[model samples]
Target: MQVRSLVSFLALAARLMLLGGLLLGGLAALAEDRPWLTAEERAWIAQQRVLRVASTPSYGPFTFVDAEGRLRGLSVDYVSRLNELSGLRLEFVAPEPFARNMEALRAGELDLLMSLRETPERAEFMGFTRPYVSVPVVLLRRVGSERQALMPGEPVSVGQGFAAADFLRQRYPDNPQQVETDDKSMLRRLASGEIDAAVMDLASATFQIRGEGIGNLRVQGDVGYAYELGIGYRRELALLGRILDKTLARIDAAERQAMVDRWISLQAERSPWQRRLLLAAAAALALVLLGLGLVLLWNRALQRQVVARTEQLRIELAERQRLQAADHARALAEAANQAKTEFMSQASHELRTPLNAVLGFAQLLGGDAQHPLDALQRERVGHIDAAARHLLILIEDMMTLSRIESGSLAVTPLPLQAGPLLRRCVELARPAAASAGIELRLDEAPLPLAQADPVRLEQVLHNLLSNAIKYNRPGGWVQVRAWAEPARGLLIQVADNGLGLSAEQLAQLFQPFNRLGRSEQQGTGIGLVISKQLMERMGGQIRVESQAGQGSRFILELQTS
Candidate 1:
């Protein structure tokens, strides 16, 4: 008997041990399913004795205190679940006049706010949680009202501190007296016809109608956009943000859906009398909607017909007017072109006659060696010759420009030694450099032969050299450098230690008649313009680089043989 009792006792102990193991395994699984806060996070969370949260219990279904003086609403319930999970003591505080909640938050009297929309103004002092709920903003008005649309000067109402108010303010900037009130008060006033219409979120409007028996009001239409509700905390509470975000992430999605469904069920339920009234109202609304739709279709048809007729008439009139106007404009343009061509031709001939006579007489007087004069008379004669020559050069330039514009300027391309051509140009410019007390340097490296018209190339070199000497400050230096590059072939740069051009001046440098605000320089403003065209004619390009107060570098690139 003792041996049997011992075996039975051992089996009983084994059974109890097996039962305890299963319980332990189930507890471990449950713990793994729920997330735990880190040790440091829990320590940080524990430092807060109590978190003072602000709630304006006036907006029901979203947030409000029941008649029993118990805070019971969607936001309240949601925060309670968050509090239970986070292990923080949340003390709910209510401030009168609702808007003071924001003031308390700004003043640091409130640590958190429930169900608030994020805005630029609020974001200044508060950090927001991820949006937990979203609802459409809408316009509501009394049922059976004849007012289908808001009349001018009729006052509208919007929820205070809400995006709908700002949207309306922007949409109707001319109307400044739009009433600002809470959603509940606005709905109450709307039902009593104190305002033409009120703006609120769809959920709140529905809750007011079903939960509070605000059955007199019906939705007119949506306001601009939906409002997304989120929890707002003071910006100083960064740890709070992290903690709340983590806790919110761990919340079951179904649990949140259940919360939403609970509130929706409460907001959707109606009494029997209310349902009957709604059914009757819905029937009437359907007829009104059908009538309005038919009227809209008819009006659209008539409007389209009128628009088609007006468009046809307008097209015919426009075609007739356009033909007449085009004919008149063509005649005027032809007349203007002829006048311009005639003026240029006659003016060039008339001016060249006097210029030639002056040059001829000046050369004769200066070169009369048989009737030699004194030094003063010689100098005076030289001056006359110089002025006449300058005038003759100006005439030649004008004529060349005329030919260029008329597309008659000829170009003859041939291979030429770039070294000798450039040397000759530098020699010709030496006298001017000496007169200006400027130093001229030349790079005598063996340069590749270039494909260009010798005469046109020489002309281009002369213009570059002259401009370099003319613009260089007295006692400054001018350097002529040449190099060779593949494809581009040969490059010659005329760099001067003279006043350079600014970015703004460089932009207009090549435009005819633009001297870039240079009144002191003697320039017709077309020298660079003509030079650019000539270089292109010879299959070359010329560009300049400069900076203020430094110097200028003009690079000429040409194809070589």
Candidate 2:
């Protein structure tokens, strides 16, 4: 009886252990699926067990309802994937018009929105995930419409709740906009000549025209705005936003591409004649493949001869590579000579204006006794002085740039105090800043010593300060700050609320003599180039951050001493 009891106890223990193992495995699988989700996020998800998601009903290819009254599109597929990956209950609300859906989202009647661009107005009430898809906004017009281009006075229809409507209102305000219910209505109006042109995303426009059999409309041109679509949720549901973003990220590139291909495929309806043509084409392709196979078999027979010829060609290839290297060196030399010639031409042109002013003013000054000096003559003398100083500065910048390019410029890095150097630079620029009605502020906090060439660093700082002052708007401010980074480096930033640069301008920022379309500004344009080289020589680096019409910041990083 005791032996029997022992066997039963062993069986019970084994079953308990098995049950515990299964429980642990289930928990491990859950963690693996949602590694980024924090305990707080999981708790929040538990509380909000169901998320009501909606998309525009007429935005085809992205999100739309089919004739069978089912939500189907790329966005629907994305939501389905999100649901599967996140293990969240995403219930779809009934399909509604775009404006009503937006209102529903705003009224807290909906929990999530799919495939919509996040505009500033929407951002006030909702938060957005990173864009998963981007499509260009295109203008559509009827085929052979008299409207060649979107005119200022022409009426352009855009979807009422679409981001393109807000974009058009802001960017092309002169063009009168008629807000339609959706892309379908807008396109229909465009086809019937009620609207001159309509703005919508490429996917929706193409889908509507082909699916609706509206053959009269054609894509006119891009509207310079793209719809970067993403999921948007209520602003207060910050945890939900994180959950959505993490889940979206879990959907890999291949899966996202598959979803896009499933929805955005363009297919042409083939008539009987076209079907016959396709059959003939398929037969021809089969014949071509057979010929290719025969050719491969023939090539196999001559493999040995081909190998010998390949070896000979390899020897010729090596010779060609050597000659190519020589040619590349010659090309570089010619480029350098061309650069020098262009520099000289620009320098001479720059020098002539100031030199002419100086000479002309000096000649007037020399004859001042005959004219008897007046207030205007005195002011002219000051102009002469200013012209001469500008000429001297231009010459110095040119010489410094030449020395840098020739590798003759010396940079001696040594321990130096950053605070005093920054303050001195700001003080030197204060007068210019004041004259330009710009406020210059320097951070007075203690800063660590940095390893940099003092003279070269000062030169770079002066150039940056001058630019901040010169290009600043009236009543703008320039802020200078220096701080020690955790990486044992000192970062000095000269930021200005001035006329900022575009991406194209920033690309050519370091190129010598590229004024970046600011020809009206007084600059030799080589100061930044010289500064970049000088910083590199001193074991440092310089970089800029800018957005057009916003502002610019120039940062210099040096090793902490």
lDDT of 1 by residue, 1-561 (tens): 999999999999999999878865654444344355655566666555689988776776777777898877888887889877887677787644457788888999989988788887888899877556656666678989886444566677776666677767775665444555577777777788777777777777788777567768876554335666778999999778767766764555467767777774423456799999999999999999999999999999888755357678889999999999999999999767644543453356457657767877877877888987788988997888777777667666665565455443545454556776788889989999999999999986877667766666778888888988888899999999999988678899999989889999999899877878887876667778888998898888998999976989999888987
Please estimate how well model 2 matches the true structure, expressed as its whole-model Cα lDDT.
Answer: 0.79
Off by over 4 Å in 2: 1-32, 265-279, 291-561
lDDT tens digits by residue: candidate 2, 1-561: 999999999999999999978865665556555756777666555445578998677889977888998888888888888877776778888888878988998999998888888887998899887567766677788889776457877888878878888888886889887878777777877789887788887778778888899978876555546676888888998777768866765665556667776877434457899999999999999999999999999998878565357688899999999999999999999778646743653454346445756766676785678677778877787777776777767777875765455333445565566676677789888888889999999876677767766667889999999998888899999999888877848899999989999999998899988899998987888999989999999899998999999899999999986
lDDT of each: 0.75, 0.79
Task: Give the per-residue Cα lDDT of candidate 1 at 367.
Answer: 81
Best by lDDT: 2
Least accurate stretch of 10 residues (summed lDDT) in model 1?
26-35
